[model samples]
Target: MRAVTYDSFAPDNARLRCGEVADPKVGPGQVLIQVRAAAVNPVDWKVMAGGLDGMMDTVFPVIPGWDVAGVVTATGPDTPEFAPGDEVMAYARKDVVQAGTFAEYVAVAAPAVARKPATLDWAQAAGLPLAGLTALRSLDRLAVGPDDVLLVHGAAGGVGSLAVQLGRDRGARVIGTASEGNHAFVRGLGGEPVSYGEGLVQRLRALAPDGVSAVADFVGGQLETTQAVLAEGGRHVSVADPRVEQHGGHWIWVRPDGAELAVLAAAAERGALTVEVARTFPLERTGEAFDASRTGHTRGKLVVTP
Candidate 1:
């Protein structure tokens, strides 16, 4: 099988190479997927660079990716949730870091896989799992709802874009932070767009003098901004920075749950959620895909077709 792998952690990502590798093994309660599309995320490159070495063990020649939209080709012993030919999408993080979604085939735990919505194409489906889960988890922590004024930092990026839509779906009046260039894009996602950087707090106060009821920080480095604009008793959560805990806010790390993925898929099918694919690369160009993700300014998700 053709897959991308790195032999060891390094600051440089050019070490990622696409080559022939042995097929992944299907373990108990797992399914083998014939990958159609995979999404590149910041964490993919970070993991490759040893950013997560303290959290998860890595095997040499590590394949690095987690978001996948594919078809089930086989199921392992005791797996009954799916069979051959089922279309699925997953945030397929494994305990070990050997087999991954950046390959022609990946074997993942059945519990992490969910059926892909018929309404979404493979690339869109591939873009949803990890970023959608991050947004959903942060919003869940903040308990955003009607009567709340919710603020989303980095609202034009992958997770932030989804957070804007999800907040609006929950009846919150969402104020999304983006560059001046992306203000219109954020508004299209049902958020009141606010330009990021200097005077952000002042601008937000002008929009809601009473202050925002919740803040979802996808970009981090905004603890001060979150504190300044949050109303009394307001909640806050972040996916990027752990220091949020010091400010009485939650720091979220998304976990793979088939049930949650199914809910997101249903929302996509119902036209309540959407995934944007800003660019795509063939499997052989996985290195370029990672390079694009490292830029950290893409308006939407970057996908790789295998």
Candidate 2:
């Protein structure tokens, strides 16, 4: 199978290369997916650069993706949930960081696979799994409700964009932080946009004078601002910063859960959620996709179609 691989940790995705690799073997409770599209996330590049070296063990010549949208080519024994030809999407992060979604085929645990939303094309579906699941978990942890004013940092980015829509769906008034250029984009996602940096605290205060009821920090380094603007009894969570945990906030790490992903798929089908794809790259150009994600300025996801 053809896939993108990195032999060793290198800065700027220096080691990423397209090459042939052995096909994955299906094991019990697993499903083999013929890759249609895979999403490049910041973590992909981070892992490639050895940023997560102390966390997840990595095997050399590693395939580098986690979010996938594809068709099931086969399913392992005991995996009764799906069969060949089933269209699915998954946050296919294995405990080991070797076999991954950036390939012609990938074998994933059945529990991580969810039927793709018909409304989303392959690129969009691929973009949704990791970012959507993260947003869903953050909102659920914060218990965002109709009366809450939800402040989302990095609102136009992958996870933040989804968080805005999900927060609005729950009837919260969502205020998001983004650059001036992305303010309109953030607004289109149902969030009131506030410029980040400089006067962020004042801007958020102007929007919710009493303080925001919840904060979802998709971007790190905003702990001071988050603490300054959060209302008493409010909750906050950060995917980028674990220090949030020390400040009475939760530091969230997304997990693979097909059932939870199915809920997001249903929301997409119902017109209540959408996944934005900034651009699509061919499989061999996955290195370029990683470059785009590393810029930290894309409005949504960067997808690679295999």
Candidate 3:
């Protein structure tokens, strides 16, 4: 099968190339997917640059992606949850770095796969898994509720956009920080928009003078602002900042869960959620897609169609 692969880490992504590689072997409790679309996240590029070497082992010629939407071609024995021909999406992250979604086919553990939302096309479905999981997990950690006023940092980016909507869906009064250009976009997701940096705390205070009841930092570097605007007993969580823990906030790393993926899919189906695709590239152009994600300012998710 054709895949985007890198044999070694390079800061410039110079080693990433598209070429034929062996098709993955389906293991017990796994399903092999014919990938229709894959989303590129910062982790993909970071992994390509060896940023995660301290965390997980990497096999040579590693395929780099976790977000995939595709059709199941086969399921391994004992995997009764899905069958061949099922349309699915998965945050197919594994314990090791290899056999990723940037290929024509990916072998995902059944526990990590969910039926793709019928309301979303391939690219949109592909974009949802990783970002949606991160947003959902952070919100869960913060325990956002109807009585709460919630703030999301970097609210117009992939994870933050979903966090905004999810906060609204959970009945929180959602406030989000974005650039001036993206204020309307965040508002469309049912969040009140505040521009980030310089006077951000004052801006948030203006929006929620009583103080915000919860904060989810999808963008890093907002610990100070989070500390400033949080209600006395409010909760806070960050997917991007490890320093959050020092301030009595939770730090989150998203885990693959098919059940939670199903919830996100159902929300999209109900029109309560949507995934934004800023740009898409073909499989051969996966390196360019990685470059786009590395820009740190793409308005929405970047997808790769294979």
Q: Which prediction has the highest lDDT against the true structure?
A: 2
The positional error of residue 56 in candidate 2, measured at the CA in angstroms, is 1.4
Models 1 onward score TM values of 0.99, 0.99, 0.99
TM-score for candidate 2: 0.99
Model 3: weakest 10-residue lDDT segment is 286-295
Compared with the true structure, what per-residue lDDT tens digits does model 3 show for residues 186-234?
9899999999888888988998999998999987988989999999999
Give the range of the ten consecutive residues with the poorest summed lDDT in model 2.
Answer: 10-19
Give residue 75's error in model 2 in angstroms: 0.8
TM-score of 1: 0.99
User: In lDDT terms, how accurate is model 1?
Assistant: 0.93
lDDT of 1 by residue, 11-93 (tens): 77667889999998998999999999999999998898899999999999998899999999999999999999999999999
Q: How many clashes does each candidate structure show, in the order listed?
A: 0, 0, 0
| Runs in model 1 lying further than 4 Å from the true structure | none
List the candidate 2 regions with Cα displacement exceeding 4 Å: none
